[model samples]
Target: MKNINSKKLLPINMNSIIEGHMVIIKPISKKEINKTYLSWLNDSQINKYLEVRHNKQTINGIFDYVNSHRSRENSEVFAIFTKKGIHIGNIGVIYDKDNKYVEYGIMIGNKKAQMLGLGGEATILMFEFLFKNKGFRKIFNGVISKNESSWKLFESIGSTREGILRGQCICSSKKPCDVYLYGILRKEWLNSRKKYLNILKNIKIKNG
Candidate 1:
């Protein structure tokens, strides 16, 4: 992507609470319900680390899921789209209004979309929305120990590995695997967001 054309890198849409230089993060609509999206959930290689791996998911189930999501009052579900408008993945937060913190989850189900740092960028975009826009005090997630890249993205953005459960849950293998619990406070992000965004800006995303 070195010396790429400037036009291709420009964002095609600018409507959002948090818009990054790479991807467009917006609310996941019922319109996103379809077979193309279902294929992502059913693909073993892509869903291997996801909770849905336990069951064979279908289009009707996904359709019902999205429809149900629309009625959710505490969950903030967002669909990830490339600057070119390709629906590549979804990111969401399970808002704990009583506790005033949220659990973050992300999935770049399209294999073609992984490994380009796009996932991290999408994470940051959603992070900004939760912290900067929504004024959340803290954000956290449980990362499968085998999924190093997943937790690394959180750590890179100043999230602390609070603790680890020894073989508490299995992911990616028949054997049990530890899950790393990570958390980041708003103050931490306020201090680190600038540096992280600058580093991300220097890294170019390749068109998949």
Candidate 2:
């Protein structure tokens, strides 16, 4: 990566939001709910590591969940879609208003769309939104220790591993796994965004 140039850095007040090559992050709405995205909760493979997917899910139940989340003032939930408008996943930040921080999460629900760097792009866009638009200074996230790939993803985006909760989550094989906590400060993001944006700029969008 080259040194970030003042000209190449992203503008803080850009009007268009959620633009990306492999994916687009659109605010979650009742109108966007569908069988594909809804099925993710019921899919054992897709929801293996997610705490919210532990119970059985129905269309009505999922609908209620979305409605309840939308009612919140501090949540910024969004549906992750492919450039061609195919729904693949969701991502968002849960704000801790009193503490002046946020906890973030993301999921790429479609198995067919996994491993294509779509989730990574959606995450970067969401982080940029939090830091630039929403005025959030501290952002935090966690990944199951068993899920090495996810931890790597966060590290690649410049998050620092702060702590670990051992044996907190029971895994698919019935073994307890740790959850690795990571965080990003505003100063770190200011530096990281430049390198990340450069990478995004160089990435070739296949029919995006």
Candidate 3:
């Protein structure tokens, strides 16, 4: 994997508490992707809700996608690991120049890590980095309506429902699905720090 310039890597406020847990968000590394990671891509349970097709993710394909995105301007992808060094998932933010908006996405591939608020913690950290360090004005995300867990995760972190895109996404099932758009502004995020901090606190307690 390509190395991210520490200078260019935005710094987030490590002190923000989410669910009473102190989660750390850091840059991804090649070590995070191994044979086990490839197996994750092949896992039907994990790929069911993702946009990418599992059959398309060859070893080279994974490396190329990660390296290319890492080198892109206004885009960042971080491997979500706990301070204890457990790999939970990955999260990314993409800034659209044409719309002047940033969009974010994440996945918790580890079944053991699901529903534990780790995704929310990682997202909060990334959102702070985008708004404070990158000077992004707004951030948005689209979650399939069927993915209630993901929708709840976004809302728990202060994003508001923007609108619904009917028949917007076609999953591997080949059926059209409604995509729910959610977004948060810099001002809205600033106001949500307290709630996020509380969530972080809880996460720390649970992890401990």
Best by TM-score: 2
For each candidate in turn, the TM-score is 0.83, 0.83, 0.79
The runs of at least 3 residues in candidate 3 whose Cα sits more than 4 Å from the true structure, single-residue gaps closed, are 1-22, 199-208
lDDT of 3 by residue, 86-114 (tens): 77787766667787788788888878888
Which residue runs of candidate 2 sit more than 4 Å off their true CA positions? 1-17, 199-208
Root-mean-square deviation of candidate 3? 5.8
Choose 1 or 2, whichever is better by lDDT.
1
> What lDDT score belongs to each candidate, Candidate 1 first?
0.74, 0.73, 0.69
Top candidate (lDDT): 1
Better of 2 and 3 by TM-score: 2
Q: Tens digit of lDDT per residue, candidate 1, span 49-127?
A: 7888889887667645543433444565668888888888987677676888988889998788899988888887677
Provide the clashing-pair count of each candidate structure. Answer: 0, 0, 20
TM-score of 1: 0.83
Judged by whole-model lDDT over C-alpha atoms, candidate 2 comes out at: 0.73
Global CA lDDT computed for model 3: 0.69
Clashing pairs in 2: none
List, residue by residue over 19-117, the lDDT tens digit for candidate 2: 666776666655556676668888888888887656887666655555444444556567787879888888766777688888888888889888888
